[model samples]
Target: MGRTSRKRRSTLTTRMTIASAALLLGGGGLVAVNVYASAQEDPGQDAGGGTRQQAQQQGQQRQVATIDCPDVGTSLPDVPDGARGRVDGELATLDSQITEAYQRLASNRTAAAQDPNFVQNSILGPLKDKRGAVLDRIGQDIRRSGGRPPQGLDGMAPCTGRPSEQPQQPSQPPSQQPPGQPSQQPSQQPGDGSDGGAGDGAGGDTGNGNGPDASDFVDIKSVQPNVAVPRNQRAASRGTFTTACGRNENGKFNPDNVIVAPGVSNGAHHMHDYVGNQATDAFSSDDDLANGQTSCRNQGDKSTYYWPVLRLQNGKDEADVGADGGGKDQNVGEIQTPSSVTLKFDGNPTSKVVAMPRFLRIITGDAKAFTNGDANANASWSCTGFENRQLKDKYPICPQGSKVVRTFRFQSCWDGANADSANHRTHVAFEDPRTGACPGGFKAIPQLVQRIVYAVPPGPGFAVDSFPEQLHKAGTDHGDFINVFDDKLMQRVANCINRGDRCT
Candidate 1:
């Protein structure tokens, strides 16, 4: 089903915070701890003397940003009433299936963790498989409904910890640069396309630092297209992207090539990373990155990048705005859907397509400040004794009654002045899957639109489009994932308009 617009408040606000890729660890090897800490340490280290201290300091910084949705519900606009009913019905069914599956598997987890011999191979390895199944089911629903995942739940995902705690301090520092670092010159830009390029520097040759300008942000009001019914019953007109070149031609913005790796299939392991081209390195460790399909951009290094963590610009009090307020809370983060499109698993080095779940924006919060008294002992786990401490490992495994809430870095995000700009603090987009089924050229998926704020400035000096040329281009080839213009969805749209509901 296409996205439906519900009522929202005028001052839509949210939070911005850093998101960590690994789970929060209460205790682990000092060596492992140090590795995670280096991401954000000061470059000026005192020879060998700075290692341990830097690690601890890095851990402390992690506690700064965090967010949680106490009870915030979904906010989608522009959908047919019939489509909305179908979605609600499907979601309810999925919830029941998931809840039941987890309950049945709880005992198996405890037994397997404590006694390795009792291990019976099941879905998703342990706790993660269960959750992954739920998400996968949601993705299928999108294809069945004739629309992709709605914008709000587009790129939303859960993360392990906060940035301050797990800041990415590259091993090499500025002082360690090669002798001619500054004079070495910038990397040569690829210019094979004679159609004229966007050109040099961060903002390109246009001399317009503002970047490719798009219209002011307009929230999705409804996906139900107007039906040729009684003339008097037609609804008011809404916004649409009509420019001939409105499609994203840039390599980064193109969505046609983006896809989740290992292509969706039975027994597919959600732990693979196409960036480095291998299973994630830390799966067996305390906090596993292998729980589900990791999001990746189809660009250089393919290194997992941060999903814009949302945090309130000002330290404002948390306010619970009803569903109509467009998710306005002190710590609301904005999650967006993929703006590009590509064909389903086609035959090519990277061609692939499969129904995937609708993703949601996830927010985690920092732990309380580090004090001298916090325990430093790493939690232990063994199959024989698994039931007692399974959840303690910082992975999602849990004993039947464990009540621990997973902790990770958090940032709240809501509407900023401009939601589409890359720096609209806390806005996130769907990562194009690294598996290369997407066409090489960029093209915009007309039916799909990315969610973001284009007007607000993200920080002290950064505006929403801070990194103009950096934002990805929409896809060029127009292969549809699911034809939303199909007769089935159209019929439903017409049915809703027949009722009192408004159609856009």
Candidate 2:
């Protein structure tokens, strides 16, 4: 989205400090922990005779990393066609409200330190009230459209402060892991208490002191190789269709998400690197996309492929430092252009692929996975030579001569009727993990596998842009696609896949 000519918000003069005591529940009892007043304090002996190391450890326990709220979009029932537009606008407003509240929380750390209930009474309580009013409006819209609205939406209004400890890893069965990825292992670093081991800490400061600490990166060499090729049935559509979409060299960047928040500017709250259809703003209609310019080598594919832009935390600033979806959203750093981008579509292992409907919108991962949980997370991070090992929650610290890679393998199953769903996810589904088959009643389609590589000075210095509250966690990485292909080209894609021909 283009930057609007509105008054700019004041910048936070200092980084946030956590001084409030957090209550912990342990052994069926509530325990309060002591916290220091400032993060920049020098380690010294306390009156209680605690060592410097002990004091620093206690300080780390009290840090509040970011705000955590329930995802309202994921909890909503099917919205009526007539009310879809209103419902979507309200959802985007909800996200914007969270971003604004997070900025307040981060900037007013001193006020929070003075009063224990400052965060609850001042920030979260007011946010809850705002969200409750919006929820009521959403309910009214659905009812007016002759649709039933789900109850208990107000319960999702209240948010909490998440501690700065290591993020929780998604628990998945071995069969649930990606086709060639290995099972996750505990951190090799002793006493780190992180899912992945300690990182090299090359990123220096987590962007604006919000998230993605040293624990978010791991050396790819430490991971064990465990990639296994999937076994295909005799009737499988074994072909692949590769599309040559350039690495967004034309500088098509925007923060509008047409699929999720149509007609609303800055709906994504973060910048995205768009590669395919050039006219893909939040206001782009299907007709607009059909006539838009294409970046793909073949003119027939006017499909849109975009994802959050990756940024380096090397103490630099971009042109959007003062604009929305950039520094104003607490996403400060130099936006990194990908060195290579590969968009390939593969067929299902047990079924023949069908032509994807025109205007089919698919979102691969959850942007709010850090707090909403990793149930829908589908991130895959690895190095060039260490592609056999994939990390869902950690950025890879690539070795020399290796480049950082971010991959998103989109869902392959379509619900046959809808090009999109109320929640943007119900219309598409991933294949069954063990059987390599589509879910019952869903038809198999060409699965989009996007591999984006970056040539950076390898370390823990880069992160994908995210909503301010998401804290730039690697697990929150996601991809968005809207198929705008012509009927002739789509049929050719299906034909190539079904005929077992690898065509480009």
Candidate 3:
């Protein structure tokens, strides 16, 4: 079954039309408490009414954060070849249902505050029904294709309301700079008119009432240095291949995800900043990508590299304020273009590297890590000068004169057969964190390390675009890549790494 057999679904309609409402319940920036109700519970009575009142009196009500659902796509590993297209399309529909459900929750804050059960009866119940139907279709698709459907898929439909308590405070006061390191502030860069300052008000309501509260950011200086270098084995491939793709000066932005939702428009539900392969979109096939124009100085590399766009939380709006993936999805703010984007391929520390298949697809980090947990969370945030101090869950508060940085080191071990997988992740694996070795039966390939830098005023005033239900959480940051390098160039890349030579 070729990939082109997949049919495109109609464009995702823009359904988020809610006026901003203050969802904070208590003083000190605390959010509402989580409310779970049984079917017999009275709709008029608050599920956590007493606790809500007491917490408000004590100024410590837990915050009713975003929705949390099981990632069905990630759980299914045995989807048959003929059923992949249908499965992928249904997964995209599941995402759209969640986004629409979240919009209802955000717009009904007043009702939810009056009756805690309102969220369960009005929002979560319907969402579960919608997701259950989609999962059933997925199971049927697999069964019809001569594959046994995975068990317990229907049980994954239920989602819960997550509760957040308070912002994370620094362990200690801001520390002074180490000796020999001069104190300097981040230089102002053009793109998004953000004034250079500490951005003390960054924790305030982010134009959208949903997220990125003060709890999401921590001062980088307060964090102790946590990065450690892995030891290279005697047979390690030590060369590097750097590909210079411009910083997306052409402003190619979209909400489509070709890898996960090939035929579905607005599949990501959040805007992305594209760097290479101009023809990349939800509808592009392998052939279209192969023939696409390149942004790299070297035409041989037409690989597509992209990630969620980071935006300043300032009151200003971008051109897509009302577009499906922008404000309509609760991702409001001015999109900040990166000051620099470096695409470098590194070799394995334990063995010689091999060339990746021409169209291998890899996604690093988890876009829903806020609700899905940190098992696949791979985001790394830091400041220009303090690159040694990396943060995974919290956004970094870069000191004055320091710019923000996001880095993604993609998985380097390939399964040697399939270029992609049902979940879009199982085919590639990251080497062991401590030993730097590939898993058994896997081959080491040229690992792409993406380093992106942005010059925004230092503070929590910036956030990455995310699913509406994700609430723009920093932990959900992720990156995507598609290898479109021709055979000749791919072989050259592998040779350069094996011979320990640096090449462009």
Give the best candidate by lDDT.
2
TM-score of each: 0.20, 0.86, 0.84
TM-score of decoy 3: 0.84
Give the Cα lDDT of each candidate.
Answer: 0.21, 0.75, 0.73
lDDT sort, best first: 2, 3, 1
* TM-score computed on alpha carbons, candidate 2: 0.86
Backbone clashes under 3 angstroms, per model: 100, 1, 7
What would the per-residue lDDT of candidate 3 be over residues 311-354, giving only the tens digit for each residue? 88666666666677877787777788899999999898889999
lDDT of 2 by residue, 1-504 (tens): 211122213322322222211111111111111123332242555666566564444333344446788888988749998899899999999999998887777666544544557778888889999998889999999999999888787688788876644455656543334454444342343222353211113233343455566677788888767566568999899899999989988888877788888878889999899999987888788888888899999999999999999987766666666567777676767778899999998988898999999999999878888887666677688999889888776778899999999989888899899999889988888787666788788999998999999998877778899998787778889999999889999999999999999999
The 10-residue segment of model 1 with minimum total lDDT is 471-480
Instruction: Give the Å shift of residue 187 in candidate 3.
Output: 27
Estimate candidate 3's alpha-carbon lDDT, on a 0 to 1 scale: 0.73
Instruction: Give the CA lDDT, 0 to 100, for residue 203 in model 1.
Output: 22
Deviation in angstroms for 418 in model 2? 0.4
Stronger candidate by TM-score (2 vs 3): 2
